[model samples]
Target: MIGEELEVLYEVDSTNEFLKRNYRSFHDGAVVVAIKQTAGKGRFGRTWYSPEGGLWYSVLFKPKVHIGLHVYTKIFSVSIAEVLKKLKVKVTIKWPNDIYYEGKKLAGILAEAISENNRVVAIVVGVGINVNNNIPDELKDIGISLSQILKKKVKITYLLDEINKYAWHLLVTYRNEPENITKLWKKYLYPKEGAQIKFKHEGEVLEGTILKISDEAMYIDVGGKVHVVQSIHELVE
Candidate 1:
């Protein structure tokens, strides 16, 4: 029941922002999709290059039980990767929430939460996929489209149906067996042990080696000290 209402728009500034502004009116399990986004957003205020042929959408979920923000992000990443596998595409998830294929970015997930009186209310999950779009020259080295990978156009409707199916399944699992979701996420993680990486945190750049990953943070070994990073802006490897 994750996508009970699908709202289709020809254009929008940002699907996540749109849902946040009007979430009070929409019921739970509502979805907002845009054909083109002029100002699509990414993690840490980055702009997502969403053109006409890509899939840009957001889903509103009202969980019965309280779920941490990091856990919610992992749910969507795992669901998206599951759908892509059904379409005969192999994908790996970068830490915290990015979908990568063959070392290039294929999709991104952004989760925003709404709270009232110190209690959680609703969560908006935004997803962007390079379905049939053309990657720009500047992004060609880092971005890729499904059509480009498959050498043919992929039907948007079919992709949406598959995504909705996996989304609902994951949501139910999260409400019932949350630990299993975390196991699935770890199974799809891209990096190996002791890999060197760099990330931006709190307006400062730090380099570290991966030590371990918990539910909501990554433990890294930096300068002979273990640093726990709850969120990262960029992954420089």
Candidate 2:
């Protein structure tokens, strides 16, 4: 039911922005898909290279619980990863947001909360997938897509609908189930437990292993010292 009203546009500055700007006019499961995003962005305001042929879209949700934005992100990440896995893509999540395959980024999921009268009215979750777009030469080492992985063009419409169906189920389950969301994300977590992870820490690259995860932060063991990280930018590979 997540894509009750799927609206496709040829272009947009940002699907997330467009949805937030018109959330009041659309239903809870309304989605906006863009063929090209001129000014798309990822975590930390990094400019996303969303050229034509890529899958860029945002979904509007009004869940029953006022959970943290981070929880929504984790839920959506799993949704996207599971869908990709069904395509034999073998994608994994880089900590809290990015979807990676074989150490390269396959997709990125971002979420932002919409507020009204000091209360959240809706949350917009956006995903950008490099389906058939050509990865820039400079970013080729860090970027990937379905077309590149499958060696064939992918049906954007089919993939989009599948992701939405899975995401809707996960989001609804999260709303009703009294369970830890982190447990679910860990299933497809990158650099699996005890694996050496080199991430940005205090202006220095440190090698560590993820020891634990909580709703607020992840505990990493670096040189016998445990560090708590709450930012995804620091943990992204």
Listed per candidate, the RMSD to the true structure in angstroms reads: 2.6, 2.0
**Candidate 2 clashing pairs, residues 3+ apart or interchain:** none
TM-score of each model, paired residue for residue: 0.89, 0.91
lDDT of 2 by residue, 140-223 (tens): 998888899999999998889898888778777776552656678888886566677667877998878888766466788988
- lDDT for each residue of candidate 1 in 1-237, tens digit (9 for 90 to 100): 867788999999999999999998888889999999999999888999999999999989777777777777888899889988987899999887899999889999999898889978999989999999999999999899999989999999888778877878887766667788888988998774477877776678789998987766778898998878776445555
Find the candidate with the highest lDDT and give its number. 1
What TM-score, to 2 decimals, does candidate 2 have?
Answer: 0.91
Cα lDDT for residue 34, model 2?
98
Residue 132 deviation, candidate 2, in Å? 1.2
Q: How much lDDT does each candidate structure score? A: 0.86, 0.85
* TM-score of predicted structure 1: 0.89
